[model samples]
Target: MHLVVRPLSTVKSSLFYSTSSHVPARAMVYAQYGKPSEVLSRMPLYRIHKHTLPDVKPQDVHIRFLAAPINPADCNQVEGVYPIKPPFNTSLGSDEPVAVGGNEGVAEVIALGDQVKGFSVGDKVVMAQAGRGTWRSHAALPASEVQLLPGFNSQVSLVHAATLTAHPHINVDNVEHHIGDYVIQNGANSAVGQFVIQIAHAWGLKTINVVRDRPNLDELKEYLTSLGATHILTEEELSKRETRSKLKGWLDGRKLRLALNCVGGKNATELGRYLDHEGKHVTYGAMSKQPMAVPAAPLIFKDVSYHGFWVSRWTDTHSRQEREAMFGDLINLIKEGKLREPVWEKVSWKLNASEQENETAFKEAVNKGITGFGKGKQIVFFED
Candidate 1:
């Protein structure tokens, strides 16, 4: 990895946001941890003070962010509740140390470091590091922090690439899912759950999805079914014996190999009854805000395996090469149309624009990311 040392004179003028095209940038920042609505603020970039008579650093690349999505975890980080907290620093224009908001976004290399090897100007890249302050119009980062996609192909849309990091782990290690195995999941319409359906489809795995009954439940069911969800059931339906029997017969006596529990509570417990002997139950989220309650009988008699899934923790134990291989495979699936991204409410964030407009765009996107506005993921994209 190369280190970037900016020139002293250049750093002085760029201290509170460089008006120079060399590193024009702005970011969503927070000085103190608190609620996203209360603490998050739009701030200018502040380059480091260094020697005068400088140009773009040899080991630094200026990124023009194409698009970024606001994930639930990103909001949690801003609230100071996430395990992996972004470091707060005076890198941006501020009296006190501050951290930039956003974890996933795609950017293009408008200007490249003279010593940069693999990446080049106009090459598209995504954030390789978590909490690297992605919700910005422009950024000057070390070449190592970003990754150039295979073949340096710009064919991948920013929307699709921005979503890539959010859900690749459902198909990786932990539970050892196999092709053609029957897998079950709750919160079937969620971003993570949707990816599970598509990835399972790509691998010939069948899914039995569980969701809460909603006013537009049928439409949502149709959408997921189109994404290759084998069966869709409401929480009430999944909890009842009558509906359970119907699915059991549909399985034709094949053991349900895996149960993915994102929504805990009675609904989650009800899923265990259908598992085959020694089957695994993986809990990834508690959308219902309820604790997991597994019947004692399953552990004693049926020999069920109950496990929790945490992507951040998984990355810590796995090698970078392993993670990259999985990501590359998923991207190919998307390219082949074997995986489809959920419809997003695109929020246009213009670069080098007014503070009010930029703030409005980000505020709206962040609000939607929290509220799931229009029942879709919220993405902030640039004009050019």
Candidate 2:
């Protein structure tokens, strides 16, 4: 048998490698945590003076951020309420040591460092972990913390790329329930909840989405139903027995297998009452700033489970390969047009002139509730 000889040039380009380039990177820096207006006003504006792409160490890769969303978690981080804190560095040309702000974004690989493997320049990627700055343009991170998506289609818009990073990993592939599997969510219109609804629908699961009866209820429900939501319920309806009785027909007397709770307090407790036996209630956010209280009866008799999830912590625990796989599936669904990003309000950020004005704009967007919040995710586009 003749041995097959492969060309060396093709092999080298397919693997991880770094090349020198003259691209400048910019970043948004914060000196301290406070209210959005105050803290964001204090953000120091800076651009790389020289092309000093940090020499990629064995496990590092350089990323050029395409887009990053202005998530509530990012606001919480600025307010000093978030659990994970970004490292503050004084050497970055700020008078006060500054930390970068941003949690979720999609990026493109510009270069790879020595000892890095399986990734190269021009690869589309997502942060394997959250809390790394994705606000500006470009970052150097561990290869283990960056997941490459070779099969990701560009048809998935930048807004969807930024927003999808906020969703939790639900094992939709192995989910035992089908399209009629009654799923309940409080923040039905939230970026994360919207994704949950779409993914559940694609997996043949039914959804009971709850939102406050804002002025735009009809429009919001129409948007969600377009994503396959089975029913929409307002907070007022969820509190009534008659409404709950009406839901029984949809579940066909079968209990709900999953409940997604972002707003806590009474809303969470009430949603807990509708779960079928052995169902799981996953709480990812405390939008109401209230603690969830579950009656012991459901816990002891119904054998329900309450789980709290933070995407940051989830990324830290899961391997990079696992994240790539999860994102691969998500991107595919997006490519198929089954998943879409919610309405996005763009906040333009200019270096120094409009920084203060934009900070106020950011705060205003965050203060809007339910349907009142403009639409979709609020994206900050930084321009040089």
Candidate 3:
């Protein structure tokens, strides 16, 4: 199927054809960090007022955003808790704060600079940079910072591209394993965890997922299993002697070589206990906001290794070709229906009517992970 291709100039012109009717687009902007209420306030949106697109350097490509996700890091960035911050550009005509919020999203290439290669106007892509002005309608980013997406079903395109921003270092091809080799992950129901489950399954790896029990435990397990998860266990289940005995039998005495941990407190420690000798545990997030503590036995006896992973940092260190290859593998998995986007609740991005509603929904979703407000991430949809 042929895809619709439009230049950045064309999109801008069509939107701002008449000056009198033009309205600034809404975005989540912040200046200082504090509580979520203090940092993220609904402010007047910005748009391309005139024909001048941001001057694209030889190494840059212009993109019209299709969708962007509000990740925990995005929220933390708004609260000034994150280390990487987007440079505040005053030239965008915003007097207040001069920052836009967002980390992950899918975009369509609208324009490419003279020095660019292997990209075209219609390619679907995701940003390599984690936190930037992705919440806005358009972005002019370095060519090397964009990872092209393989042709994907439009319904799953946004989730596939958005969730990939967190684990830029994980390459499905680099993983050496076959069906039934154990892949373990804590926070198994998280957006990233769900992706890990799907990708691991697609690669023929068996996953042992860990989650905190919710009211709908059975439903959640069913959801994870539907995504190809082999085993789903709550923290309570893992703590049970019987369950551990069953797990040992399930592995047929084979040790778990890989463990992905997002939660860093006792949960991480628990996951570490299941690791095989010389195994690797990759910690990408601290959802609990607690320091990770490991029992000395695992380090001394098992010779296990713990590594911290921040996808943004990894992407900064890797070549664009490497990043694109990882994304391509993920896209192919999605196309084959082996990978599915995590269950998400949608929020409308319409400013005039839905601004208040969106804020309430976002706040509720953010609190849900901690306070049990709801299940799953809240996705904001901006329509043309």
Best by TM-score: 2
What is the Cα-based lDDT of residue 298 in candidate 3?
Answer: 82
lDDT (C-alpha) at residue 258 in model 3: 83
Residue lDDT tens for model 2, 106-136: 7877776666678766787877777777776
Indicate whether candidate 2 or candidate 3 has the larger lDDT.
2
Q: Judged by TM-score relative to the true structure, which candidate is superior, 2 or 3?
A: 2
Query: lDDT tens string, model 3, 142-242?
Result: 77778776555564668666666665535242345656789888999888788888777776778999999989999999988988899999988887778
Worst 10-residue lDDT window, candidate 3: 13-22
Residue pairs clashing, model 1? 8-50, 8-51, 9-51, 9-52
| Backbone Cα, N, C clashes tallied per candidate | 4, 6, 0
Off by over 4 Å in 3: 1-26, 41-59, 152-156, 169-175, 351-375
- lDDT for 348 in candidate 3 is 54
Q: Which ten-residue region of model 1 has the weakest summed lDDT?
A: 45-54
The parts of candidate 1 lying over 4 Å away from their true place are 1-21, 40-60, 111-117, 151-155
Kindly indicate the candidate among 1 and 3 with the higher lDDT. 1
Candidate 1, residue 182: how far the Cα is off, in Å: 0.6
lDDT for 59 in candidate 3 is: 66
RMSD of 2: 5.7
Model 2 quality (TM-score): 0.86
